[model samples]
Target: MSSIRLFILSSFDLLGPMHGHRLRIEAENRHVSLWTEISVGAVYGAMARLAEEGYLRQIGEEKDGKRPVKQIFEITEEGRRLLAELRRSGLTEIWYKHDPFDLALVRLDPASAAELPALLQARLKALEERLAEADRINAWAAPYIGVTKRAALKHGQHRLRGEIAYLREVLDDIDAIVAEVAAGKV
Candidate 1:
C-alpha cells in the first residue's frame, strides 16, 4: 500500500469515525504537510478510494445546517488487520534512493556548467527557508508534542543544516571550476 493510504488509515485509527472534512482538519491540525507529501485536498479523494475498496465504509451522514451532507467513514475489520500488518512490517522498512538533484548533477555538462551555481544557490535558499519554517514548527510543537516527536523535528532540521553546509562546499567548488574554465585551464 502507498504511504498515503497508510496515513489515511492511521488517521482513522487515531481519530475514530470522521467525515472527509474533519479528517482534513485533523491532518492540518497535526501539520502533516510539514512532514509528509500528503495534502489536505487529497484527503477526500483518498476517502472515496478507500470506501470504494471496502477498507472504509460509510457509517452515516452528517449535515451541518446549510452545508451539504457529509459522509461519515470508519475503518473496517480488513482495514484494521492491514493497518496492524503495515505497522508491524512497514514501520521497519526504509527507502531513500530517490533525489532529483542527483539526476540533474549526473546529467550536467561543461556547456551548461554556468547554470549549476545558480541552481545550487536556489536550492540552498529554499533549504534555508525550510529550516526557518522548521524552527517555527519546533517552537509551536514543542509545547504540545512529546520529547521523542520534538527530537524527530530537530533531526529533520539537523539534516537540512548538513545538506546546506554540503551545498555551500559544492558552490565553492563550482566557483573554482568557473574560474578555471574562464582562464581556459579546464
Candidate 2:
C-alpha cells in the first residue's frame, strides 16, 4: 500500500463514504491489517490534521452496539486539489539510491586523494574490526540460528566472511596501485 502521508485521505476521496472502521475493514479485506495503535493513531491523526487543513471533515456518525459513535469523514475540495497537485508532481515515482564508498570517492578533493592511502588504511582497519565483530556475533548466534534456520544462516555467514576477505584483498590492491602511481612507476 502507498505510504505517502496523504494516502488514506486520497483513497477516501476516490472511494465514496469511509470512516476509520470502514477503512480498516476494507484494508483488512485486501489482506492488510490497519488496526494497530500506530495505524489507528496515524489514521485518526491524519484525518483530524487534514480536517484542520480544510481537506477533510466529519460529516456523519454511526453507532455500534458495544462502542462509542463512529464519526464518518469525507474529503473536501481542498483535499482533492492537494491530491491532484501530488499526482501532477508524480511524487509516487520518485526514488533515491546511494552508495557510501562511491559517495566518498565522489567527494574526494585532490588533497584528500593525495592522502587517500591513510584514509583507505583507516577504513580497512575499521572494516577488519567490523569483520571481527561480525565473527563474534556469528559465534554467539551459531547454536540458535543453526537450530532455527538450519543450513541457511550458516551458509550465509560463510559467504559474508568470504566477501569481507575479498574486500580486504581489493583494498590491498588499491593501496599498491595508488603507491605505484604516486611513484610515477605505473
Candidate 3:
C-alpha cells in the first residue's frame, strides 16, 4: 500500500504467515535494529493495507483468551509477484537506480575541481535536510521521552546523532578530496 510494503512483506516472507507476536520476534531476529514498538505499528498498518489491496490473505486463527485475536496472513499470488518485481525492478535498464549515496560517489568520478565544491555543497544540503527531519521527529517525540515513545528518545537521538556524524565525516572527506584535486594532488 505504501513504499514500506517491501519491508513489511519481507518481514512476513521471512516469518511465514505468522501473527503479530511471531512477526515481531522474527523481525527482531532478522534485524536486531528494528524496534518492535515502532515496527509493530508500522508492520500492522502495512499488513492491513496490503490485505485490503488483495496482496495478503488471512490464513489462521489466533485467539488468546481475553486478548484481541490475531489474524494470520499468507502471501497472495499478487504479493509474490509484487515482491519479485520489487526485488528485481532496478535491473530493467530503461532507468538506472541512483540512490543518494551512490549518486554522490558516482559523480565524483568525472566532476571537475570547480564542480566538486558545488556537488559537495549540494550533498551537504541534502544531509542537512535529513538531519533537520530527524531533529523534528526527535523534538516531537520529546513529550513521550523514554516512557511512551515507541522508540526511546535517547535511542532516536543517538541514531540521529550517528547519522549526522556520518554525514559530517563524509562532508569533511569530500572537502579534503576537493582541495587535493584542485591542487593537482588526487
Candidate 4:
C-alpha cells in the first residue's frame, strides 16, 4: 500500500469532506513530507485517482471569492476499508534499504583514499545537521502532535544519530581503513 494513499484516505476520514487544495494545505501543516512519502502537491492527483477508483466521491463544488471552483470529496466505505488494510500492512511491515555508501566503501580504491576522508566528513556533517533539524521540528510540533507522530520524529532522529556514530567510528579508524584499502584488503 502506498503511504500517499493511506495519508489521503486518513485525512478524509478524520477531517470530513474537503477539496484537494484543503487536503494539500492540511498535509503541509502537518509536515507530512518530513516523515511520509506523501507529496503535498500530489494530493490533487491522488484525490482524483481515488475518486475514480470509487474510494472517494465528489460531493460538490465550491467557489470562494475570485478563486476557481473546487471539487470537494468525501471518503467512501471502500476508502475506510482500504485505510484499515493500509494501516495493517504498514504497521506489520519491516523495511531496510541498503545504502550505496556501503558498496562504495567496500570497493574503495587506494587512489581515492584522500577523497574518502573528506567525503565521510561531509556526510557526517549532513547527518548531524539533519538530527538537529529533527530535534527542532519535534520541539515545535510536540504541543500539537500526538504520541505516534512524536515517535516517528524520534525514530528519524535516532537513525540520524546512529549514522553519525558510525561515521565517527569510521573517521577514528580512517588511517587503518586507508591502509587496508591501499593494500587491497578492504
What lDDT is obtained when candidate 3 is compared to the true structure?
Answer: 0.64
**Residue by residue across 1-186, what tens digits does model 3's lDDT show?**
233576666666766787766765655654424322345446677778889998888988899899988888988889888877765652342432445865555445434766766766776677677667767766665664456454534555565566567766766787677777666654
TM-score of 4: 0.89
Regarding TM-score, does 3 or 4 come out ahead? 4
Query: Global lDDT for candidate 4?
Result: 0.91
Q: What C-alpha lDDT values do all the predictions have? A: 0.82, 0.62, 0.64, 0.91
- Residue 77 shift from truth in candidate 2, angstroms: 0.5
**Model 1: what TM-score?**
0.84
lDDT ranking, high to low: 4, 1, 3, 2
Candidate 4 ranges with C-alpha deviation above 4 Å: none
For 1-186, candidate 1 gives per-residue lDDT tens digits of: 366677889999988999999988888887777666688789889889989989899999999999999999999988888788777765577746577876766566567777778888899999999999999989988999988778768878888898899888878788776666555554
The segments of candidate 3 whose C-alpha lies over 4 angstroms from its true place after superposition are: 1-3, 32-40, 90-186
* Per-residue lDDT of model 2, residues 30-144, tens digit only: 3222211125335666666777888888899898898999888888888788878766664456533464876665555544557776777787677667567656755765665
In model 4, the Cα lDDT at residue 166 comes to 91
Regions more than 4 Å wrong, model 2: 31-41, 91-93, 97-186
Q: Which runs in model 1 stand beyond 4 Å of their true positions?
A: 175-186
The most accurate candidate by TM-score is 4
Error of 1 at 73 (Å): 1.1
Task: Estimate the Cα RMSD of every predicted model relative to the unseen true structure.
Answer: 2.9, 11.1, 11.1, 1.9
